[model samples]
Target: MRRKHTLAATAVAGILTVALGTSAAQAEVAADCGPGGPGEFANHTLLVFPGSHQPIYDFVNSAKRSIDLTMYELDDTTMEADLIAAVQRGVDVRVILDGRVGPGSKYYQPGYDKLKAGGVNVVWSNPAYYFTHQKTLTVDDRESLVMTGNLDSYYYNSDRDYALFDANPLDVRAIGQTFDADFADQAVTPSAGSGDLVWSPTTSEDRILDVINGAHRTLLVEQEEMYDTDVINALIAAAQRGVQVKLAIIEECDLYPYLNQLLAAGVQISLNNTSTDTLYSHAKVFVADYGQWDERAEVGSINISNTSLNENRELGVILDAFGPRNQQVLDTLDSVITGDFNDGQTYVATTDPSCG
Candidate 1:
């Protein structure tokens, strides 16, 4: 069990995104990573999900090797069905279901019992005050599908939801470490909660804001959901301080009621919604100072609210956004807020305004 590289870390949430451009400055020519292509999913050995990915669990059936499923709560029809089929074929399946899958909600107890009876390795994580909200699955640590939307049977078209499946090893390892850490610890603390993210959350929120506050050029963000006042305030400060701060949020429904407060705070806010496209813009990410000033950073997923911060579970990864490989990621992520979506669908404020 004690193997190479002990995973000491964690996952991301909604709006399936395929990032396209991000660099440090015009001074620094953008590093062109190769075309986007997925490595074989079969190459991945570890399969983990942050919260739930029941709808797409069927994709894992493509794997021919080992599969590990982490669930604070199971009984999702998609998971149950997939696991049953996999186990029947002698696939090595282990599930860590939440301890409270019975006598409560609609966590299909019959299915839960069946999985247990069938010898599926399962863990019951109860006494949980916070949610184990991770929905990720890794394949051999070679290919990864880190996503924001849950794998439930929601009436999802590409708009109300989004998930990203990439075959980049750098991205894979980062995501892999996250899963390893979550499953390693009986208690799962995300690498990044809702609004706050980065290497250390000892003062997680404060530390991250400190980094963002110092940015000189641009700050572009695309989060599936957000409602953190502290984060929004810090961003507003940066914008007022002359840093271009632009944010992309789910339209009308400011997941965090306090978000409107940022508009008046000078944080240029944009809605990632279309006129008739009232789908859930569930992807969360932030890209800053690519090819400008002297900083480059990108990160997010279901991060930016007390629910994800303290109530629900979540994850985030910040790469050297300037890395040659991350250009597309930087561009696509930034465009979500400033490109076509920015057409007259933004709110700009002069101070921290209140949303009623």
Candidate 2:
């Protein structure tokens, strides 16, 4: 039996029940999926991109004591100015920017130079890992913002992304601890942070698969890449077992093979085009059994690729519907995902030899 935690009546009110057929064996498997017990009982706020920049700016602007940030890419001059302003206000600011080089990698030297010149304590990320893909900011050791998008101004208007403001003491402390280690280029293991944080190169694969396998009715996913075989197999298994699995991904020819396999397994797939006029699918998010008792959502910078999951420094959070505010976050996520899926074109497989 799964342990039950008491939730406030306000939190439980209006939670709709969902019914889906599951065999006894599958039910047992779902029951064993951990992270299903009580809620974190922390305050959280969700932010959707291509909507407003105020919330993020507000978080940074309000920091009076200290600011610790880790970013994969930093190209927004406005944000750079904000960090410098914070430093000028006598706030201790530290930043770690990814310095890895590769195709499609954004150059960070200009931003690094600008931040250094402006009196911000900024350093390049540790090169031991393939990349430091974590997009997180901790303010005064009190609140943390975990994000799926970069600070690049070029994608601010077109990228579909999400950020969560977590004010939980445990979550904030854990994030700060990891940032301290990462900023100094030292080895460290990230704390579970109220048992909600998901860190890559460690527990991300197992934790993510647990969420997929634990779903009894539906699973909604949005990702920028979909090349990880374990993730592909997990989604296929969930759909095979009567879970309604839907995925929205950026349209790319290299992903056709994976898309065809998912289509063959009855998983509905939608493709978002890379046009500036449309929302690009760059978010890494998952929603499972929304509106149900075990409803949960995850948002972070972890991508569905071997290097991202196994060798990169990444971070994410699993949010359970435990409080009224948390439920609101999940509700907003579900609505946005539904809209994106509906607005995207249904993918159709092509056998063109040039696709290879």
Candidate 3:
């Protein structure tokens, strides 16, 4: 069902309520209105995984009116129960689960059936795209949560993931518009929403390349897959131009060739193996020119692959260091990624069978 009031109206009301009661430390970060800058730096609450479950849970439990969720995978019972409880409390709840996992895959069916039986309005995602890889949740059209990880219980403690809480009205409205269209199985070209959001099958590739090319000093990246030639070339060009590029990635045999190319281009690489590392590198993050005035970080479900960039329904945001809270977010990201890169083993193609 469509919302009774317009998204803008609802957002305005919700924002006022939240602002009146929220503490200064927890206040919503507003977009920088200063002159001579792109309006990409907006309000956001950053959450890093393995320890972000409580914050996410609190966000859901605090919902009083409505909930709109789009997930690529959902097997976390805690979240499932929370959604069901939200529905029971008379809150309007709608969910879109990715349908492209194929017929025999048991990743999402149990949660799907459970949500339906629990009185939540849920449906399979639109199959027009290759996959609905977006992991986002919109609460009361006032706040949007964009995530890089699925809510799968097993990976809750083992994967390195990140999520952003966005309270920008434009972002919330854009997310709501896309949800409404996708809920009914209609086509949509998601809005950039304050020019901060990056959507796949439309502008993800270009936006990511822009981040890569625009970085003048340093680039810290963490990604699960790295097969896109354009992305690889951009990283190589950045490295060739003396940009310090450091990549943290999980070791995948199929990606050896690409890794070799990056290594040959003077890009430092750190490989994480599940057999040896405690945290799997499943995060899609790019911290460009961190700590500088032009510092910005990209975080979401968009992987560095052609399929994820040009085929899947992915969502990401480029967060700039505009406000104190936003700067804190970047600071945390820099610390975590630097540690991951330092702890990982350096990739040597000569020792790998695939590279041979």
Candidate 4:
């Protein structure tokens, strides 16, 4: 969607601190965002599909104590059944879905009914805002899966999407707390947890900008679209400071002005022709100073739009240069930046697709 407005800037907060639990061994971050697939299932795993559904099914099926899910869209019947089965097995299942939809509003009714009948607690998000667009899930209150796509089969089966599974107990507690607040339709401060699990209407812009500003050599980004003014400005500053910035995105109107500005400012910008990639360029990822000591990447449901950043509930995880998780995302983003990715003539300003 074309951006409706820009957010007032805020000071970047302190670094997020993760307190790992010693009761269970640390799980390796596993990611399958194409080219190279998911490596292993540890506390932190990133899974990409045509093969993503099985893990989600397994995650939900393995729920022994509780399952908390908040999604923008919910049309996947198989996964819906999995949630139901979890509930049948006595797992406390609760779901919060975005009530807002595009053309066909009744699309989610079937899935909702099935889950409700199967003993899951389902509710719509606070409709006062534009939409509750967060795609996050917590299991047994011990881990979370933050995603850039929906639970719908089409997304998992074909759309280029990314999912991060975090087993850090602190991360899970923060995400679970946010879910609890959203489920109750209450307001949240978005600062309860660390900075690594970036949240919208709060820290996404800062996290994104901080990564850009911290770049010493290079920056690689692949977003569905770019419209946030603060983020765009950070990219421009990075470019002006001689940071090699490369951005890959789908053709959309909301991003036209920013793309023009970035291009004029010497940032290497490219647009993805989704057809060539065999998947919609739907992943939202950022890698700053790739392969360097300060490398950082963020991948999740948050888009670079005002509505996404300020009004909607969105989630993404920041992968610092210290982890293997950063490698998988960096490799994928590098492909988009250096690949024959963008079309120069495909920008048309338009309204939000979800609104239309």
Candidate 5:
């Protein structure tokens, strides 16, 4: 029997349910999928582009089977043409974007419009001002590909951004939740397979903070932008209470005015050494002392930046798993956090009562 887990009541308040139609027999885990190495992507074919305008022609031409393209926008010539062509072929195509149908957007409802016209389901999940800054593609759901950078044409042609691919079982219920939610929810209604996947302009910040504050011990963070004094204070309290607190950051993220405020208050933080270029540790991950059990250890992309946390929309997956999977996921992230990452220069919060 396929058991169901009830997330915090907050997540279930308004979210709908999915009837698992695809059988468990279809789950084929490509051992290659995961981090660092070319993780498993479940599609037979994928063309990862960077930015709002990644190469579209090749993406279009490469559609040998059903495919899903993820990007923030789609206004590039090659992209438009490929999307148009794919729809005509009755390819089961879908798109997820950061913006909705409005002015000043690169590809709003137009992309959604054409896809729907071509019989493809499209969804947008960017929170308020924070652009939904994620680019991912899954072909046949049998293979999945998640990229760190956007797929714009110039970046592809210019050979910018990195792309990784691996195989994975498409039949998993939680993973399918990602695909299902992409189409079910409109721009306003956010859906989460497991509440672990935080989507914003909704309750992302609150839920994340709740998760952080609720932690019993050990909090490690690698944030490019840190502004909320409440979060800083919470971490400080955690530290004071003897919960190991460590923050790894890169100082040039544009939220410095507030970051400096935190710095002046004396928050112990470690800064990454990017040398000439700005230290770019753009991966957003958080792993607490919460021992993984029942697949609750999650790791995905949602940075603690102004855009990621409050202003721009963001997407992240909490890789919840059973004891084994949870251990693997949690241990890997913890290693990355506590290892040579902080370099001893991280800012530490002041012990003043106000700093609390």
Candidate 6:
């Protein structure tokens, strides 16, 4: 039995329930999933991409004391102006820009230079790490905005992605420490299986595998890239144990090999190809034992790759069945897997073809 926590009625009213199998009204976690009350899940705002920039800007605009942000990309001038305005208003704003070579590098000089010139304390990420791919914005060391996508306009306005705003003390403190370590270019050991926020290079892989293996009934996943062998093996092991596993990813040629393996193991795989459809998936999330009494969900910038898991700086949150955010994640998964948006191609196990 899960431990129960008491939450205000207003907080309980904010829960996002998973509506599936029937076009019925929104369900509450207290009535649907676990023994715990709505307080079991942290109160957080879920931001779906495509014109979700305003909420992000609004969060940044609300910073009162300080703002510490680390992003893989920043091409949007709207966010830039907000940062500048925050600095001008006597807020201590610090930014860590990715120095590694990539698309964001193109905007470093143009998008970020003006802020540095205007007195914002901006610096490039440590050269030792693969990439600072974590997208986080901490305000007043109390609230945090974690994301599965970049801060670029194209990602917020055009790409399929999501963001999470959390005020959980444990999550806020853990994420703040990680950012401080990265900004100082000092080695930092991330917390192992913290309450909500899970960090890479320490806890992400093992914790994520736990979620995948914990699923006694269902596992739903949506990721941008999938090449991590350990995660693949975990999913295969789960399916062999009779767990219903489903994957919906934006089809990339490199993922075909891994998708084939999962399909061979009875894991349902769907690849969204633009050649035939318009829905492209960019959200990185995992739902364990979905809709079950002990459903667990994770969403963040962490990707299933060796670099993302071990080399790059990444963050994600774990939401239990006690809240609406997890249900919202399930809602998104339902839409993709049920073909509500795009008609995805389902892959089946087949013999390896010869190049000759």
- Using lDDT, give the best candidate's number: 3
Ten contiguous residues with the weakest lDDT in model 3: 9-18
lDDT: worst 10-residue window of model 2: 7-16
| Predicted structure 4: lDDT | 0.68
Candidate 5 residue lDDT tens string, 1-356: 00022211111011000111212222222222323222233222122222222222333444555667656555455565576677677666777665532234434455556655766666665333445555566554444444444444333332212232323343223334554554455334445633444554555577667656766766676554465666766666666676665666664444445555545544446665445323344445555664634213223334554455565444554543342233444554555455425443554442334332
Candidate order, lDDT descending: 3, 2, 6, 4, 1, 5
lDDT by residue (225-280, candidate 6, tens digit) is 78899999999999999998888787665567888889889888776645665456
Query: Taking the tens digit of each residue's C-alpha lDDT, what string does model 3 give over 201-271?
Result: 79999999999999999999998888899999999999999999999998767677899999999999998
lDDT of 2: 0.78
Looking at candidate 4, the ten consecutive residues that score lowest on lDDT are: 8-17
Predicted model with the maximum TM-score: 3
For model 2, state the Cα shift of residue 291 in Å. 1.2
Candidate 3 TM-score, true structure as reference: 0.86
TM value for model 2:
0.86
RMSD of 1: 10.1
Instruction: List, in order, the clash count of every candidate structure.
Output: 59, 0, 0, 8, 49, 1
Candidate with the larger TM-score of 1 and 2? 2
TM-score of each: 0.64, 0.86, 0.86, 0.80, 0.56, 0.82
lDDT of 4 by residue, 33-94 (tens): 22212222434555554343665666677677899999888888888988988888888999
Q: What is the lDDT of residue 196 in candidate 4?
A: 79
Candidate 6's displacement at residue 268, Å, is 1.1
Summarize candidate 2's per-residue lDDT along 1-356 as a digit string, tens digits: 00022211001011111112333344233223133222221367666776545556656777768999999778888799999999999999999987574223435678888899999999888877888888998877777879998887777777888877777888888999989888888999899888999998888998899899999999999988888899999999999999999998888777888889998898999888634225688889999999999998888998888888888899999989995478878887887788788888888875657765
lDDT of candidate 1 over 123-192, digit per residue (tens): 5443342455554555444455554544444323443333444455666655556556555554544444
